[model samples]
Target: MSTPTSTAAGTGQFSQRRGIRLGYQMPNFSHAASPRALFGSVIAQARAAEAAGFDAAFVMDHFYQLPGIGAATEPMLEAYTALGALATATERIQLSTLVTGNTYRNPAMLAKTVTTLDVISGGRAVLGIGAGWFELEHDAYGYEFGTFTQRFERLEEALQIIQPMLRGEHPSFEGEWYRTREALNEPRVRDDLPIMLGGGGERKTFALAARFADHLNIICNASDIPRKLDALHQRCAEIGRDPKTLETSFLVFGFIDADGDRARGLQRDLIERTEVEPQLDRHFVGDPDDVAEQIQRRVLDHGIDGVIVNMVGNGHEPGALESAGKALGPLVHRG
Candidate 1:
């Protein structure tokens, strides 16, 4: 296997090779019939995604099912553990969390965890992290739910410790939130494990992405994409970094079926069940072709680099991801 090498300053091999243009995010596991069948279904989706030409597969890093998607009691797998299992079950597709909550683990430990995953996946791990926003998980897990500024500060410090460790260096850092003394991460497969930041906070997140991220998965409303892109550019510019060096993608909620009506119906049912207004701007609801068109017009047309979609309604169905991959692979790869 080829060892990973560093790319451009803010970019990593993942984005440099455009390996995340069309990603499959598995955020719902309740589709499985039982606990024993859950992981089989997960493997099936990952295989379907890889066979259908998706470049990456992601799982949400949450202890419980997130609100608006399902009740808190729904089944939720540990992200890194799932990814480690996935690395053995699949080949060629990158594995990661859509965004790991920074508060959930110690920074150096997180670094070692991802490095081990890189070795297991033969260097196909991307550290997708953010200043974790889900307060419920924090509360339930007994992790501190700090102020917004404090969370960002912790995330920054985490990155400071993580970056060096990923490259096989012992880093000693002291911060108000976290401190590491010559922490070591060993048994690495490659030096340049890519990092992806997920969120749309133009002030803090964008600045951090400019400084630390290899890719930015912008999580915002569709209409806000252009403005967000502009803000991201400004952040990069402020750091004297070229904006193009930091690749970007959008996270979209998908309700897709071959039958467009069925897809829309699913979307409607989700709204009714959750009793929360759908952020339609962040959703793609239709058949494969229709969703592809929506993504092209709203996402790719806005200068975003890629798309990571979670098909909450029917992604686990045998051919659901295959159909989506057939339609979307060409669209994002065209970039």
Candidate 2:
């Protein structure tokens, strides 16, 4: 457990306009290393990513390996704990889970948790979150797994508490799903710690992002980027907020290998093993050049501000981060 530093309160390190730039999401934790050695492997990856010009480093925020990623029994680290430790192991890269599930902890708990992370990391916390989506984990953890609409309702209620609390305000929120009596968050790092909302729901997600989020990680298909961005623009207009104020990025699943042929094989194996549909347009399964080209053509062409790529296959290799970065860094803006 980490404690917040009082001296850091109300002092944010970054602004929303700069955006995420380029991020590496650590999706594969299963290295050849043993359990005790696993974190060392992760540290190497994070250090490699930072050296490769990746601005942020992320891990999935799930108790179990996701259905398409790995088995439930596979080793999974509690996110904030890992991040607090990661804060010490690396410098420069922003540390956060891709998007935290809202159902796992109470709003005040989550708020205080992120605040503590910010304080520990010298103010590099990005509160990446979404309407809790993984139902199986919720059931396993005894968290309420409601219908999709119900979950969004809960998320809306949760944010009503989370947003104000992040700013060092003890909001007294009473919603159908949650009730807090002037919930207090102590030792906050900044009044404006960036809030990044993940997901691409037109009506529900964008509306909330337009209201409360500093950034929006678009999780929709590549082809849907144009339409979804347009919808985001409208959502901001509906709320009389400037869409530019809410930075945007697309979450791209990738398979980066120096050997194109071997990379293709790894891609096929990953898809087959996970039984998850490959985002053909959004995902790339080839060498670094291929990754860079696709991002420049598809992502930047559509006016997306930034791209967050998670290489689930061969990304844990020793020199993979450098190779992947060599290919993708030219197109990515570093601020």
Candidate 3:
């Protein structure tokens, strides 16, 4: 098997120049007034992020809304379809799902889908993927939800097939879980479309990222970052790959408002509504300055390469993402 070329410099112009230091994630669509207004709201936020200097824009790839964010019946857009439309709607910001579940599509088909997105986006597509989780979605959508080890095994095999196809090579592989015979991917805007793995499993996820992903978006709580980074470094060492070659970022659930009190209130409401313990390490709820300070202290200071914030509470409101961008852009893009 041929080693896939490095995509560290091929995510897009923004990534090559600034390396995804600041990203906006749109995780909830319920804020849209009605079904007809959904895509418009998404476009508005994407444009705002681009205008506010965000390096990338992300959406969740799920058939149903995530548990903590909203009810399952709430609006959830198909990730690739949304991204394809976003490609025409915005100009600069890179577009992708925060992490695409590998179980949702076949490896070869997934390769072709993202390659099409890359061509449509004019080289601004990123293949952010992970081993499938969310058994509820799988059950509801009729995708097989296997045991934990099985899912990881499938992911490993899928990558074996995906990596070469992403590089325009026809790879033939026969694995217990998946098989591809000289699968072809043509019409790709660039061969090295970046693949970002999102998760914080110290063993499996990190090791796979070291071997296959150009970036690793750490998705665990903030307190776990140091340990996760250490694990990721160890994984790289095990494979004789430099840890520095894998760019890293942390996921933050933010609730930003100009008024600090209002931001706190919003956070409280979410906690009350979801009836779950607030994982403070993964959340930043405050005024712009407050959120930025928390991110700098908790995320950037830990040596993570970037921050991807999902402001589900108010991100759809006018100026919400802009305010976040204004505060976070400078912190992540320092000299």
Candidate 4:
């Protein structure tokens, strides 16, 4: 098992690769569902996703819905709290945020929170973190929204403390953005809880992933996948780490429906509503077959480790999760 997760295992750097697996991100608490039913809707979608053969499920870690998805006032649940509840609701599917914004919490507290999640979920937690990018959230919540360089620096310090703690070791580090005095995460469920680092910063992110992360989920223009993979490989090699040991995946925006026409219609409406040009490079808009084929050709063929798709439209509706999985599950498993 590639560390049995993207977050755990070993002393220095990750040394193994988990086989490719599929995942879904439930990102629709603010759209079709009533405000009162937000968390329930999230739980239901997560349950449906697991039943439909998704290997993992995720939600965004943010105080506000992202600009393209909804307004800031849209219902956005706290990530760990929702995941803690999901632990009781699920038996097999891995649970995590697509990527946790590091600035939202203190590094030590974040490590402890993830450790608690690991214990609660029976070792089903993954630390998917990134140099937080949502400036609006930071400004809104009174977090120090620093420059890009500063955020990456903070993230590096965070991992120094977080990774060792995940492995049941206490680490002390003092840096410009953070300082830890022998901080530790106790009662760790497992020493090797996989750590996944998300984003596509070629210099900062890939290097950090090489040194600290077991998985790297690339978030970028779809046309950039191959180049990004090459860059990641180089980052691993530069640090004398094996590239294969760092599993990889891409975030796909999927607009799925019963048929192509319906899917495209939904897609067009979303485009009109958002008033933004569609980013269809790694995105899929069609029936199961269309989505699956695009995933196979664009993602797997590029040697990505996995595919994590987000059904942007109609995901909360009945039969959507199962039907989409029926088409995409085979491809995800084959990876």
Number of the top-ranking candidate, with lDDT as the measure: 1
Candidate 4 regions with alpha-carbon error over 4 angstroms = 1-20
- The local distance difference test score of model 1 is 0.88
lDDT of 1 by residue, 1-335 (tens): 12222222232223354457889999999988899999999999999999999989999999988778878899999999999999999999999999999999999899999999999999899999999988988888899998999899889878888877887678777677777787878899777788899999999999999888888999999999999999999998997888888889999999989999999999987777774567877889999999999999988998999999999889999899889999998887873
Query: Would you give me the overall lDDT of model 3?
Result: 0.86
TM-score, predicted candidate 2 vs. hidden true structure:
0.92
| Selected candidate, larger lDDT, 3 vs 4 | 3
Instruction: Tell me the lDDT of model 1 at 92.
Output: 92
Which residue pairs in candidate 3 collide?
A: none
RMSD (CA, angstroms), candidate 1: 5.0
Residue-pair clashes per prediction, in order, are: 0, 0, 0, 11
Which lDDT value does model 3 have at 249?
Answer: 94
Worst 10 residues of 3 by lDDT: 6-15
For candidate 4, the 10 contiguous residues with the lowest summed lDDT are 1-10
Q: Give lDDT per model, in order.
A: 0.88, 0.81, 0.86, 0.82
Runs of candidate 1 exceeding 4 Å displacement = 1-18
Model 2 spans > 4 angstroms off: 1-18
lDDT of 4 by residue, 1-335 (tens): 01112232333645243333789897767664566767777778889999999888998898887767656777788899999999988887888888999989887898899889878888888888999998988888899998999899888778877888777776776666666666767888677788889999999999999999888899988789889999998998987888878889999889888888999887777667663466767568888888888888888888886888888778888899999889988876762
